[model samples]
Target: MELLQLQYFLTVARLEHVTEAARSLHVTQSSLSKTIQRLEDDLGVPLFDRIGRKLRLNEFGNSFLRRAERALFELEQGKQEINDLSSPEHGTLKLAVTTASSLPNILREFRKKRPNLQFHVQMLNMQEMITLLHRGEVDFCLSSPSIYGDDINTQVVCIDPVLVAVPKGHPLAERDSISLLELRDEWFVGVKKGYGARDLVDSICESAGFTPKYVYEGDEPARLSSLVEAQIGIAFIPSTAKNSNEHIHYLKVEDHDLVREIALLSHKSRYISRAALEFRDVVVEYFGEMA
Candidate 1:
C-alpha cells in the first residue's frame, strides 16, 4: 500500500474516529474515509470496526497499525538521514529532554555554539521521551535514572542529589540539612511518575514510612516551587529543579538521601549522524567536566 494510505490508516486507528483523525491531519473526513476503505480492500482484511459511525481498530487493524507505524517512522528517519548526509550541519536535530536544572545551561551552550543549527528540543516527561525515542520522533533523549529500551544505549552523565524546596520564611529553609522523616506528612508538589526527581521523592518517602501529600505534577515542576512559596506545599525536587524564585528556599538532604542518575539515550543500532555526534560530544564534554 502507499505510504499516504498507511499514514491515513494509522491516524484513524490511533484516534479511533475517522472524523477526528481527518481534523488532526487537516483533511476532509470523506477523503480520509475513502483512503482507509481503499487500503482495507487492497489488503483483503478489514482494518476497522464501525460502531455507530465511530471507528476503532479491529484485531487485524491493531496488528497492521503497529507495523505501519514502525514502517512510517523508519521511512521518515531515512529521509532525515538522507537530508543530514546531504548537508551535515544544516538538517534539523531532534532532541528530547526531561525538566532539569542543567537544561538551561545545555540549551544556552548549544545555541551559542551552533547558532545557525536547526533544532527541535522537546521538553517531555520521562515516559513521553522514551515513547518519542522508540518511535523515531527524536534522535536522542536525556533523562534521570536512565530509561532502558530493548534497542537503546544509555550512559550516565550526571548525579542529581535530592533537595528540599521550601518557602523563604519556612523553618526548613533556615536549616542546612533535613531528614526525610522530618518532612513526612508535609504537603508536597510531586513530579510526574517515572521522572528521576519524582522517583527519588517516592523512594525516600516510602523509606520514611509515610506517603507524601502531592498537590501537583507534570514537566513544569516550577509550579511546585510556586505552591511551596505560597505555603500550599513543599517538594522533594532534584538539585536540577532549582528554586529560581527568591521567595522559595532549598535545603540539602542530610543522610538517607536520594540521588538521580542522569543519562543520555539513543537507539543502539541506529547510525550516528555527524551532527548528532557533534551535539553528543558537546553534551558529554559539558556534563563530564561538571561531574
Candidate 2:
C-alpha cells in the first residue's frame, strides 16, 4: 500500500528475478521480499509465483501492474511539472536512443541553446526505449524503427538511406551503386537479428531472393564501418553514420528501399518541460537542415 512498496513491486515485476531486482534497486533481497510480502498482505492476495530465485507475476500481480505503473508515471510527471515550474531554465533531461550516430550533432546543437542543462543518456534497444518512454522514466527517446502506441507520440525527424559499405580497395569500391543481388556471394557483417537496421537489411535481401550471409554479427552498429574497413565483411550503414573513415567506401543500394527513420518519442499524456521541448525542436531543426 505504501509508495515504496509499489516502486519495489514494479521493479521486481519488470525484472522477474529477486536478486537482479534487488541489485537494481540497491537493496538487499530480504528487504525487497519483505516489502512485496507486505504489499500482498495488504492486497489480500499473492502477487507473484516463485520459481526458485525468479518471480513470475500471478494473475493478481499482472492485473495490478498496469494500475501501479500508471500511478507511478503520474506521480513522476507531477514531480517533473513542479520542477519545470520552479526551475524552467535547468534540469536533467533523461533520454534514450537506439543509435548514437546522429546524436553528437543533435546534442551539440542542443547544448549550444541550453548549456546549463544536464543530460542523462541511455543506449538501449527499441523495445527498452519505448518502455521507458511509456513509463515516463525518460523525457524523450530518439530511436530508429519508430514505435507506436496510444500513449506514445512520435515525430519522424530524419530519414537516412541505408548504404552498402565496403573496403576502399575492394572490387565494388569504385561503383556508384550496386544491387542487392550483386552482394549475394559476398560475406557480410551486420547488426544482430533484433536490431532495426539488421531487420531492414534482412528484409531487403530476402526481397532480392536471398538472405544475407553474415560472417560477423554484433550489437554495435558503429562497429560495422570498422568491420568493413578491415575487409572482413561488407555491411549496411545508415547515412547518419557518414564519417571520415577513408578506408571504407559507401555505395548506394540500387532499387533497394533500405532507409532508417530517426524518430523522437515522448509520452502523449506526460507533461513536457520547456527544456525537453527546446531539445526536441533542436533535433527537428538539425535534421531539417540536413534534408
Candidate 3:
C-alpha cells in the first residue's frame, strides 16, 4: 500500500529476521511489526510468515515480494528523477551503451563536463538498449550499430576503423592489414545476440559476402580479447578494443575500409534530461573531429 510499508516489508523479507529489519530501518520492532501488519490488512494478504523472531516470504508472499520490489524500485526511480528535475545536483542519469568501444571518447568527455552527474550505465546489447530507451529506464544510449528505425532520434558521435583481433602468434597477426575476405573461414568470437557490435560484424560480413563463423559468444570486450589471445578465434572490434592487453594483436582490416559509426540515441517522444543533453554536446564536440 504505502511505499514505506513496502520498503519495510522488503527489508524484513530480505533479512529474514524482524529484529535485523527493525534495526536497519531504525525503528522499534513493535512499530515495524505493526506497520507490516497494517500493510497486510490493506492488501488483504499477509506478506511474511512469522516464525518466532524470524520473518520469511511464503509462497504468496514470495510472489508479492518480487512485484513489490519492482514497484518500489520504479517509484524510487521516479522520485529521484523528479528530485533531479527540481535540483540539478541530485538527478540520476541512466545510460545504456551497446558497446563502450563504439564511442571511445564520448563517455570521457561526459565525465569531464558532468563532473557531478550520477549515472548508471548498463553494458547491454542493441535490443536491450532500445528497450531501455523506450521504457525510460535510460534517458538515452550510445549506439549506432543496430536496426532501430524511426522511433528514436540519434546523432553520430564518432567513427572507428574496424580491425581484426588475433592472438599475438597467429599467422595473420604479423600482417599490417587483412581483407575481410581473407578471414572468411577463420574462427571468430562475437558479441552475444542483440548486441549492436554483433550486428555490425554481421552487417560487414554480409557486405563482404560471407557469414562469420563465430565460435565464442559474449559482449565483454575483454573476454573477446582473451579468446583472441588464446588463439581460440579472431574477433572484429573497433581499434580501441586493442587496449588493456598485450598478448593480442590487432590488425586493421584493409580493402573493406570498415568504420564503426558511434551515435547517441533517445526516444523521439521523450525529452532527455538536461545533463544528458549537455553531455551529448560534449560528445559531439569531442568526436566530431573524427572522420
Which prediction has the highest TM-score against the true structure? Answer: 2
For residues 134-170, what per-residue lDDT tens digits would candidate 1 score against the true structure? 7766777887768887878897787878788888777
Per-residue lDDT of 59 in model 3: 84
Model 3: colliding residue pairs: none
In order, what lDDT does every prediction score? 0.79, 0.89, 0.76
lDDT by residue for model 2 (1-291), tens:
799999999999999999999999999999999999999999999999999989999999999999999999889889999999999888899999887888888899889999999999998876677778878788888888888888889899888899888999999999999998999999999878777778878987999999999999988888888888889998888888878888988899888778888889988988889999999899899889999
lDDT of the structure predicted as candidate 3: 0.76
Evaluation by TM-score, superior candidate among 1 and 3: 1
Number of the candidate with higher lDDT, 2 or 3: 2
Q: What's model 1's overall lDDT?
A: 0.79
Q: List the residue pairs that clash in candidate 1.
A: 101-240
lDDT of 3 by residue, 138-224 (tens): 677887563356767777666777788888778887788888888888999877767766777788788999999978887586677
Ranking by lDDT: 2, 1, 3
